[model samples]
Target: MQYGAQRVSDINLSQVRKMFEQASPTAINLALGEPDFDTPKHIIDALKNALDEGYTHYSQNKGEVKLRETIVDKLKKDNNINTTADNVILTVGASEALYSTVNALIDPKDDVLIPDPGFLSYREVVKIAGANPVALKTSAENGFNTTLDDVENTVTENTKAMIINSPANPTGSVMPKDEIKAIAEFADENDIIIISDEIYEKIIYDKKHYSFQAYTDNAVTINGFSKAYAMTGLRVGYLSACSEIIDEVLKVHQYNVACIDTATQIAATEALTGPQQCVSDMTSEFRKRRDLVVDSLYDMGVECIRPDGAFYVFFKQDNPDEFIQKALKEDVVLVNGNAFGEMGEGYIRLSYAQSYENLQTAMERLAKIA
Candidate 1:
């Protein structure tokens, strides 16, 4: 008997995982983009302290009061977005925040503009919500920057929201400030809701992150500790919006996970309020890795756009599918661009989150494949 919902069935299998089942145990995995660093000791200590103080119970449905307050200060100070604790809802991760936002904002057949070659989760979340995902095709020629013209031309009457990821995934390019300003203006005029996924904001290189929420009250800003603090295991993230949006999203957030764990919340709070040296050190290392990967790739005669932010390098080569298959034969893992979206075809994304030594080894493996 066919019992499951069609919407769930409609979601495609992950491209990032296509060869995962077949991958050799010894493969040098450059496919996943998680930071290789450990969570700082201070953050861990905060979690321990919270647990010792009997913080195991459920927090407010929105999240812990202290965490929300920290997030409010963070938004104002780091992102230049003025918001209050009432506007933020802590979630399991940015994944949950994005999903809850999509669920709260979209109905079946509603169109949501998501960047092609964007984060793997974006399309899946929209599809699972029974919403139509309209691909905002970005290109390598333009440094993969999503332009205002791109969004303006693609909007349909059915369009309700647009997802913008600076330091975008699969490309590793940050949107220029002008593009962000233009898109913000267009969004304002068109009444389109903006979902700015700034999870990588803290990992940027040589550029300041311009949060769309800074430009419009209609924006929902989603961020988490997974990337910045090496706290992926903690599973804490959050979203900030005007009260109306927060209220609606909290209804879904409340039912989906109710609240994040008390200890995790405390750790996340420390991640924000503690000395930020860990973040600086992690970014400095990531920058070194990025340079090593780019320089090494060039030396190997492979062409790639030097990423402005995040810990990935995205580039294209001839016969990428065959190249990917052959690379796997050598036990070096790389994600095909098509795995991200159509606009991503003929390209590949490799994470530089590993050590310079491991990356050099992987680059050597890539040389043989090329």
Candidate 2:
């Protein structure tokens, strides 16, 4: 008897996790995109205080009122998105927010536009929702930003939604403000709902993040404290949209995860309302690491675009599979670009979220093969 559903069987484990698990014990990991920083003292203290103050119980299904209110202000001030707590749903993480939004809005056989060589979850989530994920292929020559032409060429009458990620995963490319507004306008005109992933917004260097909802009312914005606050384990994230959309997504959130826990919500509220120096410091350090990786690759005559944000460098190679094998042999683990999507072939993504000393050593090791 078949035990698993066809959708479950169709999806394989992500290659990013596969490589990380299979790498040699001695290998320097540049595979996962997780930040190496510890959660800030203030946030940690808030969590402790919340637990001590009896905040261990279940929160509102949507989330704590304070955190939701803080997120509303954040959206207005930082993202230029005007929203209310009633239009927000706190989620398990950006992962759940993405999953819930896709499942709630996308119908079976509907087409969803996703960037090729984009976040791996975007395609998988759409597939899990029984939707067709149309690839909007981006190339290194174009700085890996999804363009108006790409959307125009690929979108069809069946296209119901699109996902856009700035300071994108694997490639670390950020979309320009003018381009963002243009795409948002086109999506609005075409009646395609935009799902904007801004998980990496605060990690950016020298680039500004433009929220899709800022330009269009028909949009869902997903963000979290994971990357920015190094709170991956806390599992706190949120989604904001018009009440019509949020109302539906809340149904999914209620069933999947009733609440994100009061302690974490209190801590997340602190993460937003407390001192922001921690965020600035982390971003400053990431910028230095990014430069080190880019310079090392350049010195080796490797081909790559200097990323404007995020902590990854997706460099081109002639034989990415063989290159990955050689890199593993050199005790420096890297992910093959094909893991992201078909357009990612012939590339390898290197994460620079490790210590400067470790990155220095990894660069030395990669130099031998480059």
Candidate 3:
């Protein structure tokens, strides 16, 4: 009676979404990942202007030329990645960028290395591509950043690719530059491709975000405006790689997405070329929220590392499932650590992307149960 394809028969809905859906309407949600900020005024104005200018049609399958060119300059100036417009593919969001890249490169039965407590999508996408996902177990002792040793322990002759996320989801740990370079060099030596998710690059605090592509030609960089510019609904993101990879990835993108919305692509152009004070201001505010949440958890006698980047605080709980249930009873929603991976079993991730006022209230509510 199942109508679904066998390829997706084993895939489950995101646990993050399940928590969000089951929470009471009055619950303080810390389960979702998107920033709480409204899209900046300038970008909103640009979207409106684009619509007025009749940009309602499909863009080139590669995305709007202007957006791609802007992304090219951004890669050079911000990421030190000297890629061209032809090497970029604008996707629906970083989600699409991740999916398309995995589908384009991974083959059935191939082994792909992913962080143990990594983003859920990485494992699901690899499975969807009919590949095996090898976990590179990271730990709190290591700030949850994947090390070269972690790579060495998990890699096999069947390993074809690896996915790395800095300022990683669930954990919010930013990988150090030296560690990233070490892994990049290791990948180079082994002839493995690297898929670096830098969607959180701009949300970093007290650290610089390094693009893996900067360390190796055998890397695909996935990023978007969703986190940085509060453009999640607009669904505009892009991937940059060598032209050869781009030529292949384009086939998956062209059929699956055709092109991103023309108006949103135009708006994305403005998000890059326009003033960036909005981005800095948002990061500064997130810094304040991050401190509040971390300090509050510590005050409640819970141990957790201060995240170097991103707006999440993954803290240890002896029974994360029980803790999550207790949190829900107190009207404060959180995601269980096990949702990320086996290594995440004793921890829970709390997103501080909400308003400072809301975070304060949520923390107070959590303190009641902690």
Per-candidate TM vs. native?
A: 0.98, 0.99, 0.99
Report the lDDT of model 2 for residue 208: 86
- lDDT (tens digit, per residue) of candidate 1 on 1-370: 9887887977787767776666888888888878888899999999999999999999999898999999999999988899999889999999999999999988987899999989989999999988899999988889898998789888999999999899788787898778888888899998899999999998999887898888888899999999999998899999999998998998888888888898899889899999999999999999999998899888888889999998989887777888888999888888888878889888888988888788888888888877
Local distance difference test, each candidate: 0.89, 0.92, 0.93
* Residue 218 in candidate 3, Cα distance off native in Å: 0.2
For the record, the alpha-carbon RMSD of candidate 2 to the native fold, in angstroms, is 0.8
Deviation in angstroms for 226 in model 3?
A: 0.3
Candidate ranking under lDDT, highest first, comes to 3, 2, 1
Off by over 4 Å in 2: none
Better of 1 and 2 by TM-score: 2
How big is the positional error of residue 185 in model 3, measured in Å on the Cα after superposition? 1.4
Q: Report the number of the highest-lDDT candidate.
A: 3
User: Model 1 segments beyond 4 Å from truth?
Assistant: none
Q: Point out where model 3 deviates above 4 Å.
A: none
